[model samples]
Target: MFLPAVVLGALVLACLVSLGTGAADLGLADLFSGSDDSSRILLVSRVPRTLAAVLAGSGVAVAGSVMQMSMHNRFVSPTTAGTSQFALVGLLAVALLAPATSVMGKMLVASACAVAGSGLLLRLLHLLPARRTPADVTVPLIGLMLGGVVEAGTTFVAWRYDLLQSLGSWTAGDLSRVLAGRYELLWVVAALALALYLAADHLTVAGLGEDAATGLGLSYRLVVDLAVAAAVMTAVSVVVVGTLPFLGLVVPNAASRICGDNLRRALPVVAAGGALLTVVCDVVGRLVHYPYEISVTVIMGVVGAGAFIVIILRGVDRA
Candidate 1:
C-alpha cells in the first residue's frame, strides 16, 4: 500500500513535469493564461506526447512483468528477449510485402511476430535449469544474444529493401514528433495494461512453473493467455513509439524488490514506476541539450542500464 501510493504520486508529478518540460514554451501556469498558441501546443503536442510516454511506459512494464512471471525470470523482456526485434521484423515485412497495409494491419502482423518471438524464448528457457542463481544473468544474456541475431537479420533485410532510414524511426524511440492524431493508437495499450489485473492471480501461480500450477489446478490456458497479452502489448508499444529499451526490465525488477512476489500487489507499482521513469527520462532528454532534443531511447539506455546493473548486483543478488 505504501509503495503503490508513493509510486502513483510520483507518477502524477512526473506526468505534470512532462507536460511542461518540452522545448515549446509551455507550463502548467499556461493553463490559466488562455493563450491560444499555448493551448494549441498543449493539446496538439505536449498532451499527446505525455500520454504516449505514459501509455507506452505502462504497457511495456506490465508486459514485461507478465513475461517474467510467466517464465519465472526477472531479467527477460521484449528488448532483451528479441520480442521487439521480431515485432520490427513483422512491421518491416508488412511494409515491404503489402505496401497497402493499413496501420492496424501492421499492428496485427507485428503482434503475431512478437508472440512467436516470446514463445520461442520461453521454449528455449525451458531447456535451461529453471530459476537457478546463475540463470538470473544467463537468461537475459541468451535472450539478448538471440535478439542481436534477429535484429542483425532485420537490419540486413531492411537495408536490402532500402528501408533502413524508415526502420531507424521505429527502432529509435523518439517522442519529439508525436502529435495528437499520431499517438491515438497508444490508448489501445492503456486498455491492454488494465486487462492485466484480471489475469494477475493466475499468472502469479503459473509463473511458478508447470508442476506448481498443476498442483494448484491453475489452467495452463492462463499461461498462454498471459503470453499473448504480453506479446500484443509489447508489439503495440514498439509499433507506436519505437522500442523503449530496458523500460520493462528495469521497472518490474524495481517493483518486485519493493512489493515482493505478489503480482496483483506489485502491478500498480510497476505501472507507476514505468510511467515515472519514462516521463523523467523524456524530460532529461529535453533539458540535456536545450533547444535541441535527444531521443528518449538514448536517455533510457543510459538510465536503465545503470538501474539494470543495480538490480542485478544489489536487488537480485541480495534477494
Candidate 2:
C-alpha cells in the first residue's frame, strides 16, 4: 500500500516537473494566463514530452517484464534482443523507399521488423544447447551479438543513404523533440499495457515452462506470441521518442525484486516504477546542464549501464 502510494506520488511529481522544466519556463499561472507563447509551448511541447516519457517508460518496462517472464531470462529485452535495431532497419528502409509514408505506416513497418527480430532471437535461444551452457549467460550474449549485427547493417544503410543524422536521432531516445502530432503514437503503449494486464495470468503461467502451461490447458506458444507481440509493438512505437537502453532490464528487475515474480500483481508496479524513473531521468537531464538539456537517452545510458552492472554482480553472487 505504502509502496504504491509513494510510486504514484513520485510519478505525479515527475510529470509536474517535466511540464515546467524546458526552454520556456511555465508555471500554474502561465498555464492559465492565456499567454500565447506559454500556451503554445504547453500544448505543443511540454505536455507531449511528459506523456511520451511516461508512456514510453511504462511501455518499455512492461515489455521488459513480459520478456523476462516469457523467456525465463532476466537480461533479454527489446534492447538486448535487437528489437530496436531491427525496428531502426525497417524505419530506415521506409524512410528511403517511402519517404512520404505516414507515421503510423512507418510504425507498422517497424513493428513488423521488430517482431521478426525478436522472433529470431527467440529461435536462437531455443536452438542453444541448454546442456552445454546456462541460458542466463547465453541469452544476453546472443542478443548483444544479434543487436550489433543489425545495428551495423542499419549504420551501413544510413551511411549509404546519407540518413545517418536522422538515424542518430532515432537511436538516441530523446523526448526533447516530442510534439503533439509526433508523440501521439506512444499512447498505443497505454492500450498495450491494458492488454498485458488482461493477459497477465496467462503470461505468468507461460513463464513457468511449456509443459507446465500445457498442463494448465494454456497454449504456451499462443501466450508467448501474444506477449512478444505486445512487447514488440510497445518498443517499436516508441522509436519516435528514441531508444531507451536498459530501461526494460533495469525497471523490471527492480520491480521483481520489490514485488516478486507474480506478473499479475507486479505488472502495474513495474509500469509505475518505469514511468517514475523515466520522468525523473528526463528531469535530471533538463536540470543537469541547466538551460541546455542533455538527452534522456544519454542520461539513461549512463544510469542504466551502472544499474545493469549491479544486477549482474548480484546475479553472480546468487549463482
Candidate 3:
C-alpha cells in the first residue's frame, strides 16, 4: 500500500512534468491561463499522450501480474512469451477477414481470435507429458515457439497482401497517434481490471495448483478459463497500445517483493508501478531526442531486457 501510494505520487509528478516540459515548453502559469497556443498544445497533445501511457502501463502491469500468478510462473508474461504475438495474429485475421470493418468490429474479432488462440495453446499443454521440471519454465518456452509460428504466419499474410507496413504499425506500440475517439478502446483496461478484481480470490486459489484448488471445491478448469480470458483481454489491450514488453514481468515481480504474492493485495500496487514506469519511460523518450520522439517500444526494450536479465540471474542464484 505504501509502495503503491508512492508510485501513484510519482505518476502524478511525471504527468505534471510531461505537461510542462516538452519540445515546446509551457510554463505553469501559461498552462493555467489557457489562452496561449502552448497551453492548447499541452492540453491537446501531451495530456492525451500522458493518459495513453498511464492506461497502457496500468493495464499491462495488472494483467501481467494476474497472469503470472495464475500460471504460477514469475518469468512469464504476455510480452515475454508471445501472447501479444498471437493477439496480433488475431488482429491481422480480423483485418484480412473484413477489410473495411470499423475499428470496434476489428477489435472484437481480434479479441475473440486472441482468446481462441490462447485457449488452444492452453489445451495443447495438456497433451505434453508432465514435466519433471517446473511448469513455468516449460510453458513459456512452448508459448515462445507458438508465438514464433504465429509470427511467421502473420509475416506470410502481410507479405501476400502487401500490408506489411500496416501490420508492423500494430506490432510496435506508439502513443503519438492517440487522440479523442481512437483511444477509447483502451477502456478495455477498466473492464479487465474489474473482472480480475472480482475473480482474484478464485485465481489465487487456482494458482495453488489444480489438485489443491480442486480439493477446495474450486473448478480448476473454469478458474483457468477465466484467467486465460483475463490474459486475452490483456493481449488485446497491449495489441491496441502496441507492445510494451516487460511491463507485466517487472511490475508484478517488483510489487510482489514488497507486498508479497497475494494478487488481491498486490494488484493495485503493481498497476500503479506499471503506470508510473511507463510514464517515466515515455517522458524520458520525448526528452531524449528533443524534436523527434523515440518509440516507447525501443526505450522499453533496452530497459526491460536488462531488468529481465537481472531477474533471471537472481532467480538462478536463489535456486
Candidate 4:
C-alpha cells in the first residue's frame, strides 16, 4: 500500500513538474484561468509529453515483462533483442522507398519487422541446446549481437542516403518533440497494455516449459506468438518517442522482485513503476540543464544501466 502510494505520488509530482517546466510559463492555475497562450502551450506540448512518457514507459515495461516470461530469460528486451533495431530498419526503409508514407504506415512496417526479428531471435535460441550452453548467458549475448548487426545495417543505410541525422533524432528517445498530432500513436500502447492484462494468466502459464504449458491445456505456440507480438508492437510503437534503454529490463525485474512473478498481480505495478520512473527521468532531464533540456534517453541510459548492473550482480551472488 505504501509503495503504491509512493509511486503514485512520484508520478503526480513528475507530471506537475513536466507540465510547468517548459518554455512557456504555466501552472495548474493558468490552466483554469483560460489564458490562451498558457492554455495552448499546456494542451499542445506539456500534456502530450507527459502522456507520451507515461504510455510509452508503461507499455515498454509491460512488454519486457512478457518477454521475460515467454522466453524464460530475464535479460531479453526490445533493446537487447534487436527488436528496436529491426524497427529502425523498417522505418528507414520506408523513408527511403516511400518518403510520402503516412506515419501509421511506417509504424506498421516497423512493427512487422520487429515481430520478424523477435521470431528469428527465438529460433536461434531454440537451435542452441540449453544442455550445451546456459540460456541465461547465451540469450542476451545473441540478442546483443543481433542488435549490433541490425544497428550497423541501419547506420549504413542512413549514411548512404544522407539520413543519418534523421535516424539519430528518431532513435534518441526525447519527449521534447511530443506534440498533439505527433504523439497520438502512443495510445496504441494503452490498448496493448489492456490486452496483456487480459492475457496475463495465459502468459504466466506459458512461462512454464512448453510441455508443461501444453499439459495444462494452453496453446503454447499461440500464447508465445501473441506475447511476442504484443511485446514487439509495444516496443516499436514507442520508437516515435525515442528508444528507452534498459527500461523494460529494470522496471519488470524490480516489479518481480517486489511483487513476485504472478503476471496478474504484477502487471499493473510494473506499468506504474515504469511510468513513474520515466516521468522522473524526464523531469530530471528538464531541470538538469535549466533552460536547455537533456534528452530523457541519456538520463535513462545512465540510470537504467546502473540498475541493470545491480540486477546482474545480484543474480551472480544468488548463483
The per-model lDDT (C-alpha) reads 0.84, 0.83, 0.76, 0.83
Better of 3 and 4 by TM-score: 4
In model 3, state the lDDT of residue 156. 97
Question: What is the C-alpha local distance difference test score of candidate 3?
Answer: 0.76
Off by over 4 Å in 4: 131-135, 316-319
lDDT of 4 by residue, 29-99 (tens): 67668788887898889889999999899888888889888878888778888888888888888889998
> Per-prediction TM-score, please?
0.94, 0.94, 0.92, 0.95
Better candidate by lDDT, 1 or 4: 1
Candidate 4, overall lDDT?
Answer: 0.83
Query: Residue 316: error of model 3 in Å?
Result: 7.1
| Each model's Cα RMSD | 1.8, 2.0, 2.3, 2.0
- Candidate 1 per-residue lDDT, tens place, 148-186, comes to 999999999999989999899989999998888888888
lDDT of 3 at 290: 84
Against the true structure, candidate 2 has what lDDT?
A: 0.83
